[model samples]
Target: MPIPDEAAASAAHSVRHLFSRRSLHVPGTRLGAIALPAPIGRRHHWHYWWQAHFLDCLLDEHLRDPAGNALSEARKLARGIWLRNGGRWLNSYYDDMAWLALTLQRLDAMEGRRRPRRRVRVLGDALRSAHTDELGGGIFWNTTRDYKNTATTAPAALFFARAGDFGRAQELLDWLRTRVHDPATGLYLDGVKADGSAGGVVDRRVYTYNQGTVLGALVAVGGRENLEHAADLVDAVSRSTADDDGALPLGSSGDGGLFAGILGRYLALAVSTPGIGARAAATGRSLLATTAERLWTGRMQAGPGVFLFPPRQEGPVSLSSQLQAWTMLEAEQACR
Candidate 1:
């Protein structure tokens, strides 16, 4: 079923309003950059990863309304990310660096400017360095190399795809399918820990973002099989992750808070893919539409545009959740 244009427009409007209301100015950043608050208690420090997502949101807004100040806002956030990270885009976590690199690439394309080549090279090197033969293959979650999880690998795959390095992206995806994919579920597991051995301990937990990132990777790679697999994952997640009331489950605070929205981004991609079957496209659309509807009805803050996830103990209203909500809305618009 087609999403009513009114629903899409309302969500977009709320996103703009939420952004204007909740986005906060971080001290010492460039003129236009702002940070959204994390959960209530730890809202003190900005979640660095969320800032990367923020840039993506700004880009989406800019594309939707080019005359708006979205471009300037994105540039400010990019500068703020640099300044806040001690004048470096590279971070301790390879996955984090991968996300920043991908976002910067998008910013560069939109602005007709290039990010420093050295920064891209260093970031790519760090991500590639983290790949090991552990658990039969996949990138480690961080410098510790203690585990290989989808949280890290999926985004790394996306970064590789965006860089026009489909060889590496496919390699990562193939390894993930072999090592951690749950065939029965048509969903990828979290990851496994390995010490240069076969079959390390596996997390086996399902996360919306992991499926989402792979969907995004498929979008970039654009093979028939990849699109088919992406559609399968979309259907699987729709059936498994959602509750009886039609709302997708919120992962948790911190990283989890950002999960559904991440999935929403790829779900949108899947629906928009050329040659997508009507059934698959409808599955993706229904999932996003219901999730957004439930979220808006159940979680909207007393303030006009703000939204708060339940089980408030998670922290002050999280910037991560805010971004997640906005991403879902942006995605809904994309699907239409």
Candidate 2:
């Protein structure tokens, strides 16, 4: 576990090159976004929205129509996923609804095809449902208030922001602010004990995604502490998860989609606020380019970097990663 200089340097160069130019030239589409993944990509979670958000930013600000031919596929995949879901949760669903809803919202802003109305409503309801029977303190993981995890809250906030339900989103945000905090390290507690605050905590390890979730959520809700805390946490996660290039390391899953999506969301938030460094925008670009290169070069576009267990069972990456990759690119454009 030394470190990979080539990967780090290459990624760092991506940041410097983009920042120097100051804009992306990505393709602009009607909302379909980009091309479909080959090898029967799983609709497991998140269509292209996660990645599409990044691409939209790129097109709106940086690249030159990088997603022209892919919009049709993007739309098809997006529509197909909703068509079958009946515009609602399909069990085992965790934090994906917000991801999808945000995608729809971004696509709506991009405006073009005018997808199914119920599809939008369904995502709307799914996001609102995140507040179902709030435990007098905050939202539950699912229909049951059995356990509360750290990761879901940020997506919850993003979903609400996109839905125009800022009030409810703010409440949940407030609850999360108090509940998941760790007095020991000022880090989030990760998981809750159902009736208590310390039990069944599977992943207490603070990862970039975990903290990114916070930054993304807080930024969406407009909280000062959340923003500062997110920035601080990001620095911590970055120092640990990121390699020399400022790109995240493979131990944190990779330097591609995970890096792009998580950091891209934070970057977008940072760009909106004043005083962020030029490196922030550049790093955002570098990550997206790296992410795109990953998708473009990996497996047959199907089983590329897709993995189920991750590090444990390499290969066969997930659709979420691709979606995350797409989003970072979109965010990169926005950074400019």
Candidate 3:
């Protein structure tokens, strides 16, 4: 499924417009609570939605190789994910490994390629190993042997859903709602302790990404008739996102480039909900269009057909964000 030289160049040139040089610091020092200098800043670390967002988008455009397979690149990206070779798969579902799971299912459906049968079993084993009743029932960050982070848990739930493991998905969603969701804003707090309460925990912030994640999870579960306390979860997201101009910080700002990737995926889910009505969908499209335009630099104008990223706020647009933007845009088009 490798793109042909010409088509690949077109894809490369179009996508390259978003790349900019930036320094990602690897930590040599550790602060009290936060992992300063952070382990892996930007190398080989996949985005929150490479497949679900951009690569998929390119496939929709018939640009991901003339053969129409986005799954190929997805597998290629999986190789770079944290736990591919004897280690754990990244650390959370929100970004690296979780993103892989989200697209893997659809890609499998589309192209029929899997992680081999043995590989699938291995992932399944890893999933069971990672689950615990610790936080009343949330999956840990790594494969059960290590720590847990709410950041990774939500995506893991989505991954389970993608693979048709609905039962496990349900358990994770229940734990998230009970443990991290704050009823007031429909927004989720960061990681919770093993006991499942925000109280006495040093971490307590309603990030846009978490809200998007929890919202997407809620939407997924809400489809079932008898799911306990489903309506309220949707209501929370609606209330939190509603407001005056710029009422809340948009997770995917137009010019954020890479950061926009998170917003792109969340907005796609928010807009796709069946009963949400047309108004919600319109607003979502408007937001995505704005972000795309802002992130567009004059990269394509260069001679040999080169795409460059604008060194805006976050330096240059990230490759992942471009894919996310493209993927979300494709989803929007299909809905219409």
Which candidate comes out best when scored by lDDT? 1
lDDT of 1 at 330: 76
- Could you tell me the lDDT of residue 245 within candidate 1? 64
Clashing pairs in 1: 37-319, 38-318, 39-315, 39-316, 40-315, 40-316, 41-316
lDDT of 2 at 167: 84
TM-score of each: 0.85, 0.61, 0.64
TM-score of 2: 0.61
**Candidate 3: tens digits of C-alpha lDDT, residues 1-336:** 211224333434355333311122212210110111223433444333342344344345543345643445444433333232234443433244554455444455565565434444455556666677664566666543334556667777766766667788778887776777676675677765544453324257656556556656655755644122333443454456544432223233232333444545566666667765466566665554444443342123434564433332243334543444344444334334
TM-score-best of 1 and 2: 1
Range of the 10 consecutive residues with the lowest summed lDDT in candidate 1: 30-39
Ten contiguous residues minimizing lDDT sum, candidate 2: 16-25
- In model 3, which runs have C-alpha deviations exceeding 4 angstroms? 1-13, 16-95, 113-117, 143-147, 194-202, 224-259, 277-279, 296-321, 331-334
Kindly list the per-residue Cα lDDT of model 2 for residues 1-336, writing each as its tens digit: 222223322222222222111111123222221222223233443343333343333333322243443334345435444443443433344455555655556556565445535655776666566555434444456656575555566667766765667787777666666767654555555655454534333345554555566666666766566556555554454445555655543321323335446655565665565433344434444544444344333313123322221122154443344434444444544444
Shift of residue 232 alpha carbon in model 1, Å:
1.1
TM-score of 3: 0.64
Clash count, candidate 3: 9
Clashes of 1: 7
> Model 1, 73-106: lDDT tens per residue?
6777777777767777777777787777777778
In model 2, the runs with Cα more than 4 Å from the true position are 1-70, 84-94, 112-116, 132-136, 183-189, 195-203, 223-226, 251-260, 275-336
